[model samples]
Target: MAVGALAGALALAGCGGGNDAGTSAGGAGAAAGGAGSTGAVAVKNVDGVGMALVDSAGKTLYFTDQDTAGSIKCTAACLGFWFPASGNGVAGGAVAGLSTVHRPDNGQDQLTFEGKPLYTFKLDTGPGQHEGQNAQDSFGGTTFTWHAATTSAAAPTTTEAPPANTGGGYGY
Candidate 1:
């Protein structure tokens, strides 16, 4: 198997390793994707990421492979750059796959999509910046690659190779 395929397995293998599963993502966050919202969260077309979910301030939401259905590998120093989305931030519309889960380390609730926890990047300071895209970070001992949260329930099937790590990975 390819390295990507192998790592994918390890990611899934680490599932249910976080706090007890809160409401299933399917139950709490599951729904058809939409472009309506009056507060909290809404859909926006992001550069490079296309139609993705954004926070009230328009910060892009992201997830990581290091996290599983009920697991969150991003903590500690990892949070220095990747901030968790507030669980109280409702999609406020018909947006699908949006929900919240309680953080095991901190009893506070965090938002999630498709069962994976959501986060906002501190590096994305300017409008339309997604420096977090594919940025690798290690939490504890697990490594993660960040990606924007999309409104669609189904991810695009791709065969392209991941970009080269010429810039080096996140060491924090």
Candidate 2:
């Protein structure tokens, strides 16, 4: 029941207005595409989860069970919690399976891992936080399960931190 309550509260927060951050797909995309920005995808060692996919800011990225290849089902209110990884920046390092999917709604390209749409959880406080792992919730009438992005069938360890974009706005 507590899980339900938390999901409800988060959903409500997603519905509220005045988000200066702007819920538009373009808000986070700009920072993701700025000049001198390095590749957006990287593999890092997360606290309990070992190795997982992280964005330019070293924040954990996730894949949803409800989304399919080349398409994203999360939109409108759903984008509130699950911010799509912008399909900008070069694929630095040797991170494999990095690609982008064309979002039909706003024409914003969303980053993909192994053909799966990628997203970051809004509630995660910082890097190494896998708060959205295995989370089950429904938003905009869609039910989905979220999981951390892993390098392969098994998680690998990497000492390097993801590239940093100091001017970017999508951290924490």
Candidate 3:
């Protein structure tokens, strides 16, 4: 009886080893595809506008138009469309006044300037395309828009001018 019990315990230990092997294999697969690995953002000075963050292949990342710091108001579905570019671990260097902001939700380091969150558009599949820019109407009830960063000293400005009077005579 003692020998039988010892043999059964050894069998159980072997079964546990098989489970561990399965887990390790699963982890290896995930790491291979860069699924959990974070890619770093490369920030550079483009012209004189400000600092812009790009991917490893030099793709531009979009910034929120709002002028705030450390807080990103985008949540839920908005996050689904515009995903933040993440760094592997280290904070990247600053450029054109923009700095790195760590996002707690995804453990990704996002580029921020004047305290706004940065993102890349899902629709933009190529480099140098600022598809996220001026996308204010995409999300209903959300007042978010994209702003392209430039190294230029003068920021792009848009002013609402007064409506012009139509000179047509009425009530004749």
TM-score each candidate: 0.63, 0.69, 0.51
lDDT, model 1: 0.63
Backbone clashes under 3 angstroms, per model: 0, 0, 9
Is 1 or 2 the stronger prediction by TM-score?
2
In candidate 3, how many clashes are counted?
A: 9
Candidate 2 colliding pairs: none
lDDT of each: 0.63, 0.70, 0.49
Question: Which residue runs of candidate 3 sit more than 4 Å off their true CA positions?
Answer: 1-52, 88-94, 104-108, 138-140, 153-172
Clashing pairs in 3: 48-151, 48-152, 49-150, 49-151, 49-152, 50-150, 50-151, 68-115, 69-115
- Backbone clash total, candidate 1: 0
Pick by TM-score: which candidate is best? 2
Q: Model 2 over residues 96-137: C-alpha lDDT tens digits?
A: 787888888678677887888888887776778877877776
Cα deviation of 121 in candidate 1 (Å)?
0.6
TM-score of 2: 0.69
Root-mean-square deviation (CA) per prediction:
13.1, 12.9, 18.6
